[model samples]
Target: MNYLRGEFDLCTGCEACLLVCSNRAAGGYNPRLARLKVFRENENLINRPLVCTQCENPFCMHSCPVSAISRAEKTGVVLIDKEKCISCGSCIKACPDQMIRWDKTGKADKCDLCAGNPLCVQYCVPGALKLVKKREVPGK
Candidate 1:
């Protein structure tokens, strides 16, 4: 399995990743629509990128009343099936990281690793975001 990693020490808060991700995922350039988010701390001295880790035991998937969220067997990416979704907000409430959200269509949305080619990782010029294989991660 592979997942996105974020390093606050390397982040510049440029929001390039958000722009690119929003364009690809929501068909817009708005950062608010991006699947991931960047948070600032210490009077904006620290910028931390927050993305879906694609947990081994994803609460978002288990909380879905209609079973709209599922982890892909091949990629381990938690995906939301809009067709089956009822927009009950269960997954959103279950996510501790607040990764899941409601899209423009009022359906649940979250990162799917862009189908294994994340635009956020690509656009993160500061290298704060990375798509890392689970085995390659230290202390995993």
Candidate 2:
């Protein structure tokens, strides 16, 4: 499956990805509301974009009491079903990366990869983000 990857050297700390992601997720331009987060590190020498890697053993999905979270069959994107969610925040708490966010509607929200083409990937400038396929190791 294809997934979004961030390259630190290519990033320019523009935060365009944050703006577009927040707008889609929060219906407003708030970086805090975005699913992914970026941190300016190394004394502002690097901007590190933190995104959900869609883990093989996802804690968020397992911690969800009502099974609201699941991996999409085709995309392998972790998703939250708002209808099934009871706002218990278990999924949020279980995430090691803290990618799960609370939406305005009191439901758990996270990156769905925009169903394929992520707004963050599209808006990311300086070629910091790219959609990549999982590669098979030659030795493996």
Best by TM-score: 1
lDDT of 1 by residue, 1-140 (tens): 89999999999999999999899888989998999999989999999889999987788888888889887777777899999999999999999989988898999999989888898988888899998888532221
Cα error of candidate 1 at position 62, Å: 0.7
Off by over 4 Å in 2: 135-140
lDDT of each: 0.88, 0.85
> Considering summed lDDT, which 10 consecutive residues are worst modelled in model 1?
131-140
Task: Name the runs in model 1 displaced over 4 angstroms.
Answer: 135-140
* lDDT computed for candidate 2: 0.85
Clashes of 1: 0
* TM per prediction: 0.94, 0.92
- Model 2 earns a TM-score of 0.92
